[model samples]
Target chain A: MATRDELLACLAQFRDRCNADAQLRPMLADWERTILIRASDLPAEHLLIVRGGQVYLEPAAADGADLTVIAESGLLADLFAGRITPTEPYLNGSLRVLGTEEDIMRLDFISLMIWGE
Target chain B: MRYVVSVSLGSSKRDHEVTAAFLGEDFCIKRQGTDGDLARAEELIRELDGKVDAIGLGGIDVYLYAGGERYALRDGLRLLACAKLTPVVDGSGLKNTLERQAVRYLEEEEKLIGPGTKVLLVSAVDRFGMAEALAAAGCDLVCGDLMFAAGIPYPIRGLEELTRMAKKLLPEMTKMPFHMLYPTGKKQEEKAVTAAKFAQFFDEAAVIAGDFHFIRRYSPPRLDGKIILTNTVTAADVEELRAQGVKWLVTTTPELGGRSFGTNVLEAVMVTLLGKRWDEITAQDYTALLARLQLKPRIERLN
Candidate 1:
């Protein structure tokens, strides 16, 4: 499990990476999605909203998220920190995502863009 | 001279044109990719509807088969409906015949496949004929449809399970946007992440076969001495395979003008040569024509 501070820092770094990537911004230009992240080991929920090709992280949860990612805090931190690729965990069933296939692929693409895939 | 065009939803960087003679008939075959734009593909098809001898719909499949059942993709069907005069085909007709025969030729003539030969097929629903032939040739087959298509890591080991899963998923899966199921446009050009997560599958198999895009996008960087059996590869693709230390590259389609055109383009060629509507052609027609043309798989030893 990751501490609340660790999760926050991880997401902050993720946000910085996305905002700094000029190529990824244009790819997500028209793609706006609300992603809810839950740390299965933590009693906390967070929201990531993308609008106008920018990503904003909220400290609180929101309803009707376009996608939901559920995993242990350590795993979530690792994923956001680019310490590991998502395919292994997602395929092995360690990471669970609730959303349409397009959203899932987009999430993977975003990770691939920020990191190297 | 007959003009045949393939309108694709893939990247335009792979567009190609070649003029060749088949059975004494001159043909100018061309492929144009719309960079994943559906409207552009549809408009291109409409523009070529009455003008060309035949049109091939590439980068998308109008029908997917498994367990002897066929399911039509909504988007693919929409593109097919755009052609009112020229016969439009998605290459499913040839995939069912040509690919199967290609497998048999490789098994019987080349001895590439035999009993207990390990094979990793990226996706089987789109090329079930090849999948079935591989099984019939007694390969230890692993179908990676779920692993590659969906994000699941499960490797299906037999056709029975593949059929069961296809029946459960294809109904809804075929309705989704085609891009979600497979790479298209710029995504097709992107490199696979350098991860060993899926490398075990590649390392375990002596032969990897199926759709070229799937094989290219997900395969591990080094193949050393493995054989790749698939359809459609550009010249650049050939060089890449050679650089990866591949020993053999076998494309189901014959090479034309230094490019292995997709089944869609070749099927369009056959349709024009036969002067028959796409709907009126049968599997026997394709087999007989393939025999007449003596169409053989293009095999090259890269390493």
Candidate 2:
């Protein structure tokens, strides 16, 4: 399990990385959605609002989200912070992403852009 | 006659059945497409498991390789696991050995590719051997893995960059539904809107290579004087290529009837002829058999 502060810090790092990537913004130009991140091992939830090709973290409930990602808090932290690739946990059933396949693929591409490998 | 069936997730419109003999051994080879239905494909694999001498899983890859690293596709493995008695392959083995040999043959004998020849490989992770061969032969290579699969505009310029990109993305990408990565079923039949967008890559290259679908996906409307290096084209597909002004059509696999089959189906044929379990076979075995069969690239000048 990861503490709320720990997850927040990791997400903040992710936001900084995304902001630093000028190339990634154009890729997300038309993709605007609210993504809900819920921790499976804890009663914690966060919101990621994407508007105008920028991602913002909202420390709130999972309301009216277009996409939802459910995973352990530690896994979420690792994934958002670029410490681990999303493929292993996704395939092993530890990570569950519920949304349109196009959205999911876009999110994957975003991660790839932020982290080279 | 030995029976070999290719259970594909592609459109049934591409289904084919042929009777052929290899080195005095008669075989009945058939392809049954499931139109991108995973469960139906699994069921068909289960039904044909023990009944068929060998099975080939098409429109999906059990594994994708890049720079010595191999990633297994989740859905592909699921379909592969349905067969308990018969050996199943997705043609990665043939792509590695036979396609590499074909690239060499074209370069050495046909004088088609050589140093400074501009080549655009539609997707390389699925055909790493050909990518490597082209790179080694000094063709100015651009790999379209990113452009074709992810809708990304970035063109990977060299093998090093391609390998780097593959290492970063393939782990997760391969885990996703195989359809999202490659076109299947009706998706295969539709012309991609992005094809015209990426036509510059096609117009600049002297040779276009890789899976026929991927090449066709990002191909421009007119490919005047360009050589297409791929396999698994129907007669209609050939005409379409001719209409596009493709100068040369080179299929890595030999022509069976009027068309050449996908590597998966051809690999299943080889498995039946060798009478070997899938795991027991090696790349050398495939290469040796390719030599014995005297299978050469089906190269035709279309325009």
Candidate 3:
């Protein structure tokens, strides 16, 4: 039962951390696209737009997103918090990803910034 | 701190902790064992009754369901009598509720199974709730109760056909203990999976749904993109699946501490979190709690 505001803050932090990390910046530089993240249970969606080796978070949709991730907010938080594995929800069919294979690989790498494992 | 203990007739091999978080609450199920002695299982329940929040009776069932008819087990009644203060559940209470939610989530939400998607359910008699949900969702289903469970080699058409078959066989099946019906012995250890043998069903079906052990026994070398819908898997099991090129695996049961969990522990957790006795919680309550938790299966890509 994470509040909407807390989940939003976590998303912002992930975006900010991704922008700051040197290892992740190089990976983000390869893709200049918007990514839409929507929660299944809550009416909250965040768009991450990557441009010029930096990632930015926006509240609304943008043109030509790279990936669209649909999952519950709790699951998203748990993934970032390293409480649950990224592949667990995806494998269980709770997390849905509409992206190329390369994008999926890069997304997993970006998650490494938040969690080492 | 809420304490939930699972009293099991299984040996130390089956006894372990299950840690998980659901609906913002972190919970744990302490596995207590009796080394396969049924009397020890009752003794443990009697010992922990008032001290613990709830108790989960493992390796046995309260009832064997056959459509509308339910045959209650004498062992289950004796165990229930042993408990004085806390609610003790054999996990049958949540079968209809949790299992139905598990199937519907895969169809309506996850979109894994559609109108024409062929599904192979290994045994409808064992997982009746899941079978009912699959049929209600309108998937072309192959019920393998007669084939897999009874060694009859007859794949029933729909849930109705399987229900009729179960009505005939489940009474006899219930005469023996549930552990005899679903063994945790050497049969569960070694999986004699040959892709060539089940190629016909694997070729036609989009998903193969069944009990975990049943699926494990018949799993092929490669799954391609076929989704496995079952319960009770371990971390080692996932690695085995990944090595076999299983692109997606969906467990009906929620995973905890790097493995899928038993229904007994799951039902006990629900009873504790709901702050209600097992008898007080209804199927509707389970469905509502399932919605609140938004429990769905996980998938992996190895191919």
iRMSD, all candidates: 12.8, 2.6, 23.0
lDDT of 2 by residue, B1-303 (tens): 999898888899999988889998888889999999999999999999889899988888899888899989989989988988999999998889999999999999999999999999998988999999999999999998877887766788998877777787887788788888888898888888767767889999999999888887668789999999999898989999999999999999888778889999889989887788888889999989998999999999999
lDDT of candidate 1 vs native?
A: 0.88
Q: Give the clashing residue pairs of candidate 1, or none.
A: A117-B192, A117-B193
Q: Is candidate 2 or candidate 3 better by lDDT?
A: 2
How would you encode candidate 1's per-residue C-alpha lDDT over B74-149 as one tens digit per residue?
8999999998899999999999999999999999999989989999999999999999999999999999886677
Going through the candidates in the order shown, the clash numbers are: 2, 0, 9
Give the candidate order by descending lDDT: 1, 2, 3
Residue B223 in candidate 3, Cα distance off native in Å: 3.5
TM-score: model 2, chain A = 0.94
Residues B3-98 of candidate 3: C-alpha lDDT, one tens digit per residue: 778786654564578656767777767877666666777787888979988888765667756577676665667888998889888778787777
- Model 3: which residue pairs collide? A90-B299, A91-B298, A91-B299, A91-B300, A92-B297, A92-B298, A92-B299, A93-B297, A93-B298
lDDT of 1 at B219: 86
Give the interface RMSD of candidate 2.
2.6
Worst 10 residues of 3 chain B by lDDT: B146-155
What DockQ does each candidate score versus the true complex, computed on alpha carbons? Answer: 0.07, 0.37, 0.01
C-alpha TM-scores of all predictions: 0.76, 0.87, 0.63
* Full-model lDDT for every candidate: 0.88, 0.87, 0.69
Give the Å error, residue B163, model 1: 0.4
